[model samples]
Target: MRSGPTAEPHGDTAEGDTAGRAGALRPRRRLLVLASTFPARPDDGVPAFVLDLARHEAEEFDTVVLTPRVPGAAADEVVDGVRVVRYPYFPRRFEDLADGAILDNLRARRSRVLQVPALLAAQYLAVRRAVRTGGPDVVHAHWTVPQALVATLAAPRVPMVVTTHGGDVYALRAAPLVQLKRWVLRRAAHVTTVNGEMRERLTAWGVPESGTSVVPMGVEPGPAAAARARTARVPGRIVAVGRLVEKKGFAVLLDALRRIDDVPWEVVVVGDGPLRAGLGRRAAGLPVTFAGQLGKDEVLDALASATVVAMPSVPASNGDQEGLPVTLLEAAAVGAAVVASDLPGIRDVVHHDVSGLLVPPGDVDALAAALRRALTDRDGRERWQAGAGRAAEPYTGDRIGARYRAVLRAAAGQHPD
Candidate 1:
């Protein structure tokens, strides 16, 4: 690891294992990251886990993030030493297909489907540009379908590592897409998914198990995060963070909150999505606050302050489900007690009745009972929080970042120090 201080705010204030990696300057290999989703800024609450991963990678690579363009965001810029290149996929006004996620955009407005061909073509062009200009040693494609497909086409000679977040492996299950996904994986030097469930899915699709890995986009566990959990834990506060969408199971969370009338709990839902308006209506007279989307610092603050974190994720109608939601990781990092669905991804990290309580995805009674137990039982909450912090240790940003960095370097025929 480079020895020196990090000019970065997040992991900069490194501690424990990462504290030794500070105050260093060195030129390193170049890395090209192709993705459908990325933060417009370092702070904006656009799910910055990708950027967080990139920031850590920047320590080892001259990282360049190429993502679809959004209105008001610059086409090219640098944030926290990492270069960001936003490629125009559709018309400036109609470029909403990439942000808020492609699947969500299509689910919200079917007309957005018209932009898919344009996005794919434009992304391929962007990858070509990145290959010629950045001359990256290896390519890191964030999603399987379009990003990996385009990367394989655009940078055919470059060794690439493909990382599949939840949607690509779980949602895009049509026979043609499944075949296409398998085809794409063949080109990757190595494949990584967020959880073992997705790894199993990828292998069943014919991806060799030996060549694949499970690496969740991780959280930065620092003093600030720990303090948030410690401070916000009083008087019973429940925080749920995720896009207000079907797969997130926020509707189920609301129902569970309603059922727990016996507990004196206040709810804070921190995200905005297509279902926000309807979800707001459903919340009705509950002690809930729609905090909407929050920036990274604010989100960490919220997570830190939360006594209990709820991740009521369920399988969407399209087969998309939680492949280890980042919210769960962040909550664990911040030392918050979690009440989550008993999904495979969640099952891997959250030990049922150990790190947190687990209930069936849509079972209102079970969810309510779990939430109520968390709120009323102080000893259990503390124990769960302690266990959560331990569970989250492997997923610390510095560790996961180094793991991914090693993978990318190995793909490029190099080795980590």
Candidate 2:
């Protein structure tokens, strides 16, 4: 059976395709992708990088995604030609485990941690059923905690590729979790990390160095059409985009903005999360607009018209940090000046004073100074924008997608011709 561009109900069944003119059905390798967060609908404001990666991999394989189900999402659907199957782990109302932000949800309520067992059990059973039915050549599991653990338990015989985004590597450092991660890493055919620091951490945690690769998430900044000329941009308009979580440092940005009131600037915060109400209260009497959770086009439009893109990311109390923020890369790709915190993952994307200004993390005064400079120095901003565009060249979706495809194929024991 060959998978085609059609939606199928969630079950242990496959659609048969007709033979081609050559009187033979083309055999495509099957891939089962395990992830926690996915777009619930077409217009959902969730990050679409995993969806994009599956779409690109679909070019060379029959890709199927297994993600946690939300209230309004379809049980099964074909998105961008990739088949998606959402598994229900809890009641519609109680399905907060993988909803908006996993880390934030757990941090907001310690009781939410009790949901982890059921979530992992449901995901493992679903993956087992999918593997038995779909018979994928390889299982691609995103995040180490639940997905990789589920894959290791459900489809131990299949070659598995595990990818860690950040939180799983940094935040979940308890002894038992670390031991579980080591067990999963030992079983995986290969492991991929979004940044070099994560790979080093994995090795430090006893994962073999030879089994890991660094593959950062990729973005295709379509064309520079949305990029505005420096003189055409708003003089003092600042834009910040990301989930309104503790790690995003929006509260700190608010403090920095308060200090920089001498400048004629306004900030647009473009995401929604558990901290929205509190962040709004913090932004009171400040020129900050809470444009809650915008679509991609609207975000690009906001970036294009801004004087600077501010991403003051800091380590959350639980040790959660970024894994190379896509927003910073998008800002660079769109020729927007950037002011961000100096951290491991972010440093890989933004070079201090070259592509963008990097300030000490959690320092409101330093962030204020950097933003003031980016807002006032037109020539410097132009130079940084040019350098940023150049720095963003290696991260185009096509290039990164091809690299990932090669790794996946190799892991599945199929080498490219």
Candidate 3:
């Protein structure tokens, strides 16, 4: 497909001036991104990895994001230098599919599954319009199932790259969904998974190893100010950052907190989800603080002041688990001592007894012991804090962005300038 004129509206210019500038400057290639979850506003704390990647890509390409609109979010707006278009899939009140967790929502109320058809249809139409009007050189789809399927149907001529962020490949294992995922993977120019284990999983699902790459979701390395803040960490303070979901293992963390009641420590839980009420009730009489859903800066502050960061993630009953938790990387970046579950992605980040401590998933006794050790041992905590910065260096935005840019350029058959 031939690249068309840019869809971006220009400020009024003299007729000759417009033509002169147009001829003088080479236009940036258009990149259309398909993502399910995106921040509706600047300060919105929705998973910002997609938004972060889009912003970095915007530096090289004219990036435009097409995502599903939620209840209170703006339908279309430019955020952080990237143009975002949110499409209405259902009635505003009923547009809950993309709100918190799609699978969790569907599992909680079976009626939410009815929104799937409209969600897919609206996304497909919006993507088709973007391809026809904006003439993207490449389409980068964030999920394997619905977003990639929508891209395949809507912009078949456009070169596409599909990236799976764990849940799509792991949890959605029904025969039909698996077949649909395989179909999308087969058609894409390239595919990416957040971790090596996920790449292996995709290979088993019929995707060729040569076409897939492991590109973990990246984070902005903590700033110098945040690093300075980490120097004065509050003693005996443990911080856990993630959605209050089953897979996050917040309930298990609460049990561990209860086990270590004699220790002079406080727990801060950052994030909100369906399990908030139940988890809060369970943490009753404990020194747990629920700082629900803060902005990125606030999260960084929490990490900076944290003596230890706990990520007690476990596999959920529905086979849902983390690909890699960005908060762990962020905490490490801030020089916080981390104690995480010994799972695939978490293990990849936290080297046992090196950068951070690792405990067996769902083992309250082991988790409590790890927390006690991190909180009480000064020299060991110092070693973990020092090594965390080195461990987090690979996940910085600059390194990850370069990798993604290279892949996107290769898929589009463009030589780097």
Candidate 4:
């Protein structure tokens, strides 16, 4: 990618610089990322994939992240070499939109619906501020519904690449909201989704096939996971990790465990969310341990040491489904034999009887049977684990980062949206 001329925010050579300034000293390009989910602190337990991607963008450009401000988070801070700017929407006491996730938060609390207008207005102002003050050459918005829409509203002339994570496409499907999504997508210079199924959805929306691509977030099999992989795997040890949300299918997982109680398998559930207490109450007597949100290394180690990993994800009641669960990829990286739902988005990782066993979403009996096979059938489990490891090779941080860098470089060269 060609580096743009070195220009600081508020300097004479602004976005409208003349040819003379374009000849100035060359420097890294600027990437302004808009996201709704980010870790407040280094160990805040929120998903760090956005931060990981920003770290990658920082390798080739000056990456800046603009996200919603949550309680106890800095308004501006640097995380892993990426500049993060958090914008406040509501009162500090009442700002609950980015608590866990925008969709999950709304599903958990009905009163939070009142905070939508404030959030939209604040995000627009933030994007406008980021564009004017940061002088970003291109914008990368993580979700289409509000982030991309807000970027277009805030800086219509700025080129943007919209990334649809999940809820933005599946949950926000009301007639009016669908039009709004299409409006933002049409204005985007390039659109990227985490899975092929979503790319097909984009094609169905009349988005040009040439302008869309599937680029998923990645996981690195670092020393922690590698070291754990060398350790002896525990027998009948099932591990599952993700937010305890309805889409995560923790309730269904508990039901599956109920049927498999005759087996000698034990489960360790990692992560936390609104449904934690309810899930706890439901898993009354099973040999289950609710290990609330661990660090990335810990989660990876647990996955690496597990005999099997379970991801019985189901579509949430509000129509929200995962674009592709990062947990699925992480499990693959650690070579854990997996039993996951046969969702379209997940097919990229979980190949039935190949990479891992696949059960229909929300099917407790099928999930139970798959788990039973993984626990008892050693040869098949090893074969599937090896297949998962091979499937995960192409999704490492280095490869995904290069792909994203290429897309951003292309968008940066395009005319403003």
Alpha-carbon runs more than 4 Å astray in model 2: 1-26, 223-232
Clashes of 4: 0
lDDT per residue as tens, model 2, 1-417: 145443222212121111121113236678899898788886567887788888877766789999998768899999886899999887777778888667788887778887888898999889989988889989889888788888998899999999899888888777887898999998898999988998998889778999898988777767444444433577799999999999999999999988886679999999998899999999899888999987766677788888899999999888889988878777888888899999887888789888889999999999999999999998889888888888888888766766676678788886533
Write model 3 residue lDDT over 302-402, tens digit each, in one string: 88889999999999988889898888888888888999999888888799888999999999999999999999999999899888877888998867876
TM-score, candidate 4, is 0.92
> After best superposition, candidate 4 residue 359: deviation in angstroms?
0.9
lDDT of each: 0.83, 0.82, 0.83, 0.84
Better of 1 and 4 by lDDT: 4
Could you give candidate 1's per-residue lDDT for residues 80-115 as a string of tens digits? Answer: 877888988777877799887889889999999999
As a TM-score, model 3 comes out at: 0.92
* Candidate 2: residue pairs that collide: none
Q: What is the lDDT of residue 281 in candidate 1?
A: 97
Using lDDT as the measure, name the better of candidate 1 and candidate 2. 1
* C-alpha TM-scores of all predictions: 0.92, 0.92, 0.92, 0.92
Among all windows of ten consecutive residues in candidate 3, which has the lowest summed lDDT?
7-16
Residue 328 displacement in candidate 1 (angstroms): 0.9
Provide the lowest-lDDT 10-residue window in model 1: 16-25
Clashes of each: 10, 0, 0, 0
Best by lDDT: 4
